[model samples]
Target: MIPAGRTPATVERAAEIFGKSFNYFQNQRLWEKLFPATIKAFHRAGAQRIVRLWDEEQLLALAAQRELPFDQQDIPVLPVADPQHPKPAEYQDEDLLDVVEAWEALHEAGSKITQRAWNTYVSRADDARETSAPAPDLEINGSRFWYRKTLLDWDKTRMGRGESPNAGRKKGSKDTTGPRIRPTAIARLAAAEGLLRALPNLPQAEMVKAIATTQNVTDRQALRILHEARANLGLPAPSPTEKK
Candidate 1:
């Protein structure tokens, strides 16, 4: 029997499967096997790899058809059900094999979500869109900022050990090996507002350098944000830095 006092979100989540593609696959394949599992993977090393790997036109075409041949691996896909979930109450002895068979059929059809692709997707997980959204969330950016502040409260020598002073986990390796850093927007706007607290404020060239070295977010994404800020927020456009 389902838990009686589940959280509201948990109950809602149980009702809707996020599986848009793989759900379609299961009913079509008539999966039959002893035990079946579905998994997803991501690759995160480079942007060019992201662009080169996925053909948008092909994906759109595949979606419109709704009859995906399982062997097509280039498309991004996810399974409908959590593979590790407990079998339903009606799963009798003979019928259990059917689930395994389904896993085999789906496996053969070629919709495996590889580990590399999953890692890549996670690497591109931007926190900005999350913060600006309606729902309340523990803002990852805000968490990091607070963590940084707690480090400064400790002695200079204690802070250098690279531990999260408040949270007690080791600080990210970058926190130690790299130069002190701040947000790109903070750096860009600080000159105009005269708040350089705990960060470097450089000339135009170094402003660009600070963006490249400290922020490490993609320039294309930054440019998009710049335009949106200018139009929507009424902030002036930041001029491109002449390459030094």
Candidate 2:
């Protein structure tokens, strides 16, 4: 019998049946390519946690086809419980754009910012009051995503002011007279921000250790970077008595 509850193991089993890596489905964008309708319906239905059994059946049927580059139309349509009732208005926006898509959109709009820089901007959006960057519109399974139109609108507003689509100090703003941060330091802080977002529930001390191991820095240095990352992301710093 098919599993009654959708869990990580269920996803893994489905991935195996679909002949795709588990991570492929774990990433929302990649998974949407295969089940766009299901995703749309899920989002439309207020994104509740319940998983429909028909979705699993659709996966199995698609796998049976053994077709490479399957057409979305070939997938079974999601049946509505009440055909007489009209569905809620469709989401007017385009498919939710992940960080990668946002980065690409900025580049296409003549911004010269690197992907890392774009990521840093996104990481700091909630705290970086100096810039007008928009915070993520939604998060799915720990990954943050923004609406395509929201990003394009932000880009257009920036471009209209003759500013680069990338975030920076406003024109005629006072330059920082304090000691400049090293490029390596900035890179490490950004990397730490990414790790913190990925493993948000990890203990502070353990997170520092993980960063130290991955970044090849001393624990003290890693702790410092993690603290700075937390500040940038508007997350609270660990208590002084907290072990590091």
Measured by TM-score, the strongest candidate is: 2
Best-performing candidate as measured by lDDT: 2
Q: What are the per-residue Cα lDDT tens digits for candidate 2 across 80-196?
A: 332122233422244354566567656765776678766666767476543536777766556555765677676655442224434345456477575445555777889999988
User: Candidates' lDDT values, in order?
Assistant: 0.30, 0.59
- Over 79-134, each residue of candidate 1 has an lDDT whose tens digit, in order, gives 21322242444222221111122233223335353344323423453453211111
- TM per candidate comes to 0.19, 0.34
Instruction: State how far residue 227 of model 1 sits from its true place (Å).
Output: 11
Candidate 1: minimum summed lDDT over ten consecutive residues — where? 1-10
